[model samples]
Target chain A: MNKQKPSQILKTTFFSFLLIALTSCTKKSDKEVSLGALIAMTGPIESMAPPILDSVRLAEKEVNDNGGILGGRKLKVTVGDSKCSAEGGADAAKKLVNINKVSGIVGALCSGASTAASSGVAIPAGVTMISPASTAPTFTTLKDNDLFYRVIPSDAYQGVYLGKLVIKQGITKVALTYVNNDYGVGLANSFKASFEKEGGKVVTESKHEDKKASYRSELATLAQGGAEALVVIAYSDSSGQTIVRQALETKRFERFIGTDGMASEKLIKRIGIQGLKKSFFSRPVATKTSFSDAFDKNYGAFSKHKRKSIFIKEAYDAAMILALAIQKGGSDDRASVKANIRKVANAPGVEVGPGDWAKAVKLIAEGKEINYQGAAGANEFDKNGDVAGVFGHFVVQMGDSFKQIK
Target chain B: MDTLYGWMMYILSLLTVGGIYAIMGLGLNLQWGITGLFNIGVAGFFAVGGYASAIVTTKFSPNHLGGFDLPFIVGILFSMIFSGLMAAIIGKICLRLRGDYLAIATIGLAEILRLILKNEVWLTNGPRGIPGIPRPFEDLAQPWSEICYLLIILLILAIIFYGFEKAINSPWGRIMKAIRENEEAAASTGKNVENLRLETFVIGSIFMGLGGALLTHSMKYIGPTASDPLVTTFLLWVMLIVGGSGNNKGAIIGAFIIWTVWSASELLSGILSYEWINRLSYLRVFIIGFILQVILQNRPQGIIPEKN
Candidate 1:
């Protein structure tokens, strides 16, 4: 090997990498206050990222158009793909916190990603992170040191709610199956505990892997349990779809119960209304608020898929609340944003909603308080930064829709 | 902090994670490069290490098994021990199968490990995972805490690197190299080839476990998805192969360089248009593959080829 060749190659590669690093270190304009969005752009939730990003962009646009943030400085959002895993989340969040120096973060959507980012990066780095889609029960008890918050409720609460709903419907014995993941496990375990406590019986339980060719053997065992219905705690596009179709064809359990993941139009299209006539699904209901009219009227202009996805409203709420917190705190400091999140989200303030950022800013300037009522609901965050969820019970209608029964 | 300091902090993260991967690269180098043991089941040992470390060190929680709340060194040892035990069992059964067949068995081991971690709710907390694994020096201030953690990782890497170097130069190293080149001839010389192969397998796996434990502590959380084969298994192979597998320094250098590329490519969006930032961000994975292909074409034996 030539002596100069190795050094030449090394120098060339080293300078190029230095160039990339230097380019990324370009400073943010002082006129802008930046935030980070940790969406799952490449992992399991890739399908859900587009609209969620749109919602975040909507919040940014709405805030800028109204009054901007902090006496008319632009509110900029930097995007980081969490990739729906711990490593991805930690890496993205580290870049956001250290390199971009974002005052607050609004994502890392998957629960596992969120947990790692919050505990490992954001909390330690003193940057506040708010997740709109992560619903693992772990965050409720995680020692986040007051730096982590989520607009959505944990799956543990929803599981208990489903448990009570099932008993109220007079269904005693049911065979349960959940796709094995954080969401499925959290919801299923909590539901089982609550159901058993409320004098109901889960005759058999099975946890199956998602995206499988068939769950025939698992279904065979579940079918033998002699149950009133089959509770499928999985997404409609994955294992839930297969289980439902197989159960229908085999004449297993006639009645069925599903969670928000199963409450979709695609289910009716494939299974038809007849097969799902005895089936009902549960989903978190968007509350009727004064802001609802504004969101319904204007959100269509901003987003193509207005109601096509879950957590769009919550996503909007998370970003908007961050902006409001920045305005209320009147500083670009990380600690300021963390201290102000609950102040702007909680009660006893002049109510503000989406597209009303100007009024909210004016209120903050006046040394008055304002509570942000967002597109989703009045997200009153508890001590753990979790909101109490309100779920709706729905049954399949004759056409391609679901009717809220209660 | 200022932008330059921010950049430095990000570099520390790069090295922290990079050092961990270097540990894994060393293990892969020992097994495949030194002993020619085709053990592709690094992900299984990795998960075992992560879960064991997490279970051993975490505070009392109803989730998963352990509430012992042991210290950091204990967590690391447990992770290595558990992974070593798994390697011993699997090596006893499948180490006899050479080359590609061993690859298939290791793949099965990875899948089985992932399934167990996902399904065994009472033990491993199922897929919800055990959160809040302790990080040493986390109680200190920002840059210092991060500095200390990175130092600890580098120190571990140094010890492992030193140990491997000593081992690679010893007479035992010559015998292992002999076995790698001509296994039948080495066995004919009565070097106890099977035991040496098993020893190499178990020792390499012990380092992989250490890598996994370090990752868990740094990330402060672990789940089944975090141990995805794409990152854990395939990436280790690329690192060792690109670094020139025969030498320990190549393994270390390859890990740092590859990880730097893997991580810094995500920041390319800083120069792109706002509309293209999110859309073009995925080109990172493509960029890594492109670089790997370019390097393979230029230098098949890697950047620092084994010096005979």
Candidate 2:
């Protein structure tokens, strides 16, 4: 065994290399139009990736089920794991663009990955990229050459919408806390600007980082200022849950408010509905027809966390919309996909809802316009390729669930 | 033809990232192989370099942020300087200790540095990070800009490798080897062993920072995730050891080999559909660990041993 050590190691290396070579020889056929999905398969928010990819695949299945895309060509989706970082994004985008040679991409959920992949790889390669959940306002001004777009509303839009809803509830004074990152800061800044303009008082504000053992110090600051309620703009599963539990235990404030980040059933289950009876949350309003019956049924065959999985709706929409663009443009060309994203997702067109692929394709075939009011909502692309979204008010119901107010 | 162009760009990127890792591997080789210092804070120095360059490229004050159009070299120089300064401080405190104690001290300190980079949003932009860093020759047309960037990286790597080789043959290089072999014996000869060790460590750390800055420039973005210890610090150590400690060429070869496998294994695994989703992504990490184990088991002295 000792004498054979070096050769054995070499053999192992050779074997693995051979495996890689054999696995990588998958050839794309001419009858298929490939789109890439750049999701974080490994990293901090890794648990969410597999499910979200399934939702995007669900869109692919939806397209292929109803005849196909681009004059009977099958829609093929190649997956690239962005790993939730800039380097990961650039690396994955390079492979997806070069090796896979996809015309479009969808669902790089992390903002950092989306920006880097867009600017570094996708934009330079002239590939159209649609992020399912990147909400940075910076993208609005990115020199993307109109090749980048997102299904999610900009943080700027959701925050401003939430501010109007807060004032409608007649809460004039409140304490505010948010996780100090791009998502939190963007939403908080927009919310503050809109709330202050609507004649409300943000008596105190504190920004805290995520995954801390305790947020008592920040909570203490928020507890002061004699505010009527405390606002939390953070993910419910982590820091948001900790802050809410600590706040109630300390009896600092009776009323609580949360933004899109806090709109989760986990909070209601973890903290109990009794303690959060007066608490309210805001999320980007999904239309009733959004996540339609067919979508729910199709997605049910995969993960049970349909409502709980973050960005599943947006991921589905992003894939479907990109498919629609390819179909409407009548080609698998990257430039045409970019050129027709707006044409397929905006008003003054034949209305298409989720799972209405057949209807949309028929309209496209007839040389009529098509509009994809998707699983998220009506995705009307603006000059900067951003879609405006409305915020929905939600409250904890008796069954440990969130009931959205229309 | 477009597909062909895309494949070419992909290969260029693999080389680009591999070159960046080779630079960092050289840094680690100097620290561990030349001077016998267990510097475990590679990621800390990396973050310092990346954030330093990012801040230099643009104004990110609380009041206003501006367009980033500064000379890329200025940011790179700043990264190396800041990293060197940080290394100087860390070396002063930890070099007094020996072996594993020094490793523990450096690791703890680096964690503190990581937290500072993460929490201090004004400088590093926290987790959201800074993007749109203009790279040298990025404005040039496709493939050429990429080609130019890769050339600069390889050119830098060659210069550093040549410098290291010359240093190894010089009196300083011989002294470093002496200190590594028998520290007490070298000190008895009044060689100022402490100062020499500190210098080796600081120089090695400077290279780590340089590598980080180049990476940020290549990606045109940086975030807290860029400095993740698993990806940066631990990965560099693997490259150094598997390549061959105390061998400059070994380090370069090691970096290219390891990083190519790391990135390309992902590409290879990308062939697998989501039907095997759970196994696909982790397969890259698994392959890397397997390679490291095989290399360490077969050649503990590395692919290129320190030649007498």
Candidate 3:
């Protein structure tokens, strides 16, 4: 009986293993295409991830509902939160690539996280990453690798836009308050250089430590410099909000201009409508594409609110681009999907939105041409896989809404 | 429904993070509350553990510092031992100094360690960090997979906590406390005060290293930024001070509560109107500071003070 028990146990274990493997293989065979998203669902940038994720989901649903990517083969998306930190981003990337075996990924939103994850795991494993919103200029020169791409224009372009905006506003002198991190420092320096080149003067520049309270002294110094306008390049954290509040409370500058990081509704909410009245910031203009409207509708319904974020638009566009690329490549293979990403993203001709993903995919699969004009705007991919878009300056009017001023 | 789920997930994540902090805080509690060793370099030892485990287990290549791809259990064990060795060396050098001088020396050492991590790109990947670490039990099926993994981690943590409680109640623990209270007397009693102090420092650091290793695994990423003195050093001290210095339960509770508050505030700031939540973010830190002040003023012994 004891000898029979050992054989019986071994037989049961083998059968169990076989069943598991067979089930897994069958599940894989049932899916036509698989994609992954690594977003900062928790941590400092967690607030920004929801919009992006919502958009991705919406795009995925549209594609799958329209008879999948490769003719009846459905596309599936697996989401992982990167926590906006380098380590978290890498881990999320690894899970998506190693465990999920996804063909493409959509995020690692923050520059530092994206950089770390791309170098640490994504590039090494040959997984394609296309960041929709990460705008750090250094990404352009990242190890001469082609695996990483961004849909948004680099900070360098944004700096130039801000510089032109400053000139347009006739603000002769500006005071710069930047966070002491790579994102802030890069934007601040670029803005300074562009502004100086455009014959505008930067009165004073200072850096604020992250998560620091009481920037009254720093604002006091900037106010004392007698600059007509103040430009803040920082994230939407407590410290950055405090800096904005203090600048207004101290009555230092006439008007405040900020980068995309400070362009969130959360920033205005933090400072209050009264404080935000005189503030203007540069952000990617939200195009009135059908895809964007659909995303907005879905997200508003999901959040049970009337408002939607800019990141939602970017994320939706990223997912659509990825799906279109897969269809265009004629396969769900990682390398093929990656190679066709730029082709679909920048396909010359008619524009396609989220609702038209089916038609777009069909056309691409049929070997016809297509161009994707996303909810965020014209997604024309350059050599570096970055999209060039128009930057608009908006004035915070009331109730977490902004009035776009050309 | 999604929002509530989001909150629950957030709470779970915070608890996981707090569990790590609790372990590190316990290490601090052992040194300051029991052995009276002022270790301002807590973050340094933690970073050492993370880097050691990462480099040891990662697949090595010619262009990069190759890792052995050893089992994570073995990597963690080695990391703890290495951290203990480093702490012993540092403790021997700095234990002779008393009061603020020792604090300053340890703080300086912590800064030096951070700089080394930042500059040694060839070894530590510089400021960019190491990513794509393998998680234990990742091969399991989904649905209950993550939960099972978390349960395993929690079980390990419980064992460590119970083990620590047992050690603190032992004769060795009593001697360490004796040295803390009256060093000269402990020396006169042939306790070999220096050796005792060094031994305590090493043991405490081993715990810190283990805590760091667990954290890296949970996060699945390790970076120099994670080891920043601001995040590691300040938060660990806050947990230890607010939780009650000498109590294990206090440490765990403090970590959970503080981390919960921190994470909740972040979520709340996202959901609430920007106006209401904006200033609240900055105010959150001050709130913690206020909590610390209140704790010190009202209950100097902490919510769970160490017992004699």
Clash pairs, candidate 2, are: none
**Of 1 and 3, which scores higher on DockQ?**
1
Candidate 3's C-alpha runs over 4 A off are A1-8, A19-23, A44-52, A168-173, A180-183, A199-201, A209-216, A223-228, A234-256, A260-281, A297-307, A393-405, B1-44, B47-191, B199-225, B228-308
Ranked candidates (TM-score, high to low):
1, 2, 3
lDDT order of candidates, top first: 1, 2, 3
Can you list the residue pairs that collide in candidate 3? A269-B274, A269-B275, A270-B274, A270-B278, B60-B66, B60-B67
Residue ranges of candidate 2 with Cα displaced over 4 Å: A1-29, A209-220, A223-226, A235-252, A263-280, A301-308, A394-406, B1-3, B59-69
- Candidate 1 residues A254-313, lDDT tens each? 799999999999988988898999998888886877786677666788878756477787
Q: Which ten residues in a row have the lowest lDDT in candidate 2 chain B?
A: B59-68
lDDT tens per residue, model 2, A78-117: 8888888877888889898888878899958788888888
Every candidate's fraction of true contacts kept comes to: 0.65, 0.61, 0.09
What is the TM-score of chain A, computed separately for every candidate? 0.86, 0.83, 0.81
Measured against the true two-chain complex, the DockQ scores of the candidates, in the order shown, are 0.57, 0.54, 0.09
Residue B128, model 3: Cα distance from true site in angstroms: 8.5
lDDT of 2 at B138: 80
Interface RMSD of 2: 3.0
TM-score of 3: 0.62
